[model samples]
Target: MEGRNLASINYNILDKSQQKLTIAGRLDMENISSLWPEIFKLIKKNKPKVLLLDASGVDYCDGAGIGLFLKLKEKQKENKGSLQIENLKPEFNQLMELFEPGQLSKPEQIPSFFKRVPEQIGKSLTISMREVYSQISFVGEVFVKFLYTLFHLGSLRWKDTFLIAEKSGANAVGITALLGFLIGVILAFQSAISMRKFGAEIYVADLVAIVLFRELGPLLTAFVLAARTGSAFAAEIGTMKINEEVDALTTMGLEPVRFLVIPRMLAAVVITPLLTMFNNLFGILGCILVMITMGFAPITLINEIQHATNLTDLFGGLAKTFVFGYLIAGIGCLCGLQTGKGASAVGDSATRAVVSSIIAIVVADGIFAVIYYFLGI
Candidate 1:
């Protein structure tokens, strides 16, 4: 080890290889700025394949220090280096845990309510209620603005739709399939147990058919938008915000809402139903897989589901999903508009967008449920 001792940081260049470089040091907020220029310069000069930073002696690192370190580490890829951190202290360990946390991480870990998906959903929903209730004009404006958006939508060129469909579809397909199949499996398993107790195990197929087509289709499709498409919108619009394109649009006398928001919102309106149908198909496929393992006759399962559900179940779910598409797009675009001064704002806005979309979807689902039940279709 060759030691080049600076004030608080003692840089020990441990080894050098074609594929990697190793450095061990104590990095604190107080000393970080002094070493950055030299450290950044070394990075530029070495251009190694990987950079292993052994921060075993890092006693303290504030947000600024942590921020700088993350930036340097992020630049590693462009420099052909993969930054791997080791020997983090307890505080640093807690930070990592917060960023990438929980037992969903480990199979046997049952996760806490506040930290779990349910809690996140509840929290977002509560916020949504407050927002919607706080301003009656916002709801009126949203509806009016959406109606205005619809008229301009029909005049929109076909190429815009095609570009949007390709991007939205490709982004959302995988997560939608995985989550849809999982929900289907759990539904079939749970419903089968209940139906079996009632000597109606055959009804498991009916639940999958009706419930998936009508409810889970919209629900899952909206969640997919919350995760996949909403994040993308925030990131894209965020980059635009970062680049001042949104501001430029205003200077040019163009409405950022009409030019940017309309395309994505309309795309969601068109594509979500298509995705929901796909989700329903995959969900059914998953249930079929479960059926095979449960000693249910595949032929009988098909017959019962076919007889139990009709156009209403299939079409109703699809229709609800179309509404969800609008909600997802609307919330995402709104959050993007709220993005502020920096990359941190982009990240923060994207998170808010996803959380808002999920909450909006859940609330919309409940509203739709009430409407559908009273209609008694």
Candidate 2:
């Protein structure tokens, strides 16, 4: 036989009831096709009561070889005899085990729904705790890096910071102004209806100024940034992560958090308050327009606004914007850095960033309200 097709079979008739079949060579598909037919013919002609297959010399095998052995075993059984496999190499023994019918046939038990409920709850709680611990640790690391970079001004990317500021603040002015104007119009229209009955229509200025400056301005600005800039940060960082750009930064001894996150955080901190101020301006302008249509002079509306709102109200709103900005940018960066592998991961991170930032802003705003009430701000 050619060396390329090197399968060979030898039969030794030990006795009337016994025979041995020795197969030596590669038992892959090509060789098995020619070799199996001859081997089966010998077995059928001899009609041995007991057959022993020696497979120690098999250097390679495939599924066809295993199928051949199973066929021989069945043939021997049909002849009222037995087939025994002997001298199998470790690799071939593993192959034989794979074809064993009982390997994966174990019966499985189904759990009751009541038992599964607590089990699922426990698993979910464990996963949530682990995620909380990881997030806390990551936040701590980012804070330490931020403090270090504060002393090393050259380490900060000033250009990136300014670019983010412009994108998050300047580019968002149109939408912010439109939203603020509409909110102001709605508030004035609704309040004017009630106030005109009591002959207190002029106090509409006080209501609009107090509500906008103390709450709506900062809250609405935060909502806008959380939806726009926050989602952008998460998507940008998540793409970097998937492309291994973050890993490359680590390999080059650069801190990804400091390089990527700090600039965005600082920009948000500077821009959000400024945006809130602009939103307040547009909101008051909307109220002015409404009051002018109601037969009040522009000067009269301005005077009422000035008399009604104090510096404390404006400053309180600005202060809340700062906190909201930090939370939005920080949460966005956190979600991005924590992105898992996959194409869907970027979308998921962006969604999580927006949701988490909004929740944080709302909770923080409530806490601020409580604090201001206690401090009499």
Q: What is the TM-score of each candidate against the true structure?
A: 0.61, 0.71
Per-residue lDDT tens digits for candidate 1, residues 1-377, read: 33343334333444574333333354555556777777777777776566666667666665645655576566786675687777767797676545542222446776786679887899899988876764354445556666776776665545766787779986678878887888888889989888888999888888888999888877878887778888888778888987989999999997676677777777888889888887888898888889889888788888998999999888887878887888787777777776779649989988998988898788988988898899986
Quote the positional error of residue 290 for candidate 1 in Å: 1.6
Local error of candidate 2 at 168, Å? 1.5
Please, what are the lDDT tens digits per residue for candidate 2 over residues 222-330? Answer: 9999999999999999999999999999999988888899999888988999999889999998888898899999898888989999999999889999889989999
Task: Provide backbone clash counts, one per model.
Answer: 0, 0
- Cα lDDT over the full model 1: 0.75
Leading candidate by TM-score? 2
Candidate 2 has what TM-score?
0.71
Off by over 4 Å in 1: 1-157
Q: How many steric clashes does model 2 contain?
A: 0
- Estimate the lDDT of model 2: 0.91
What is the lDDT of every predicted structure here?
0.75, 0.91
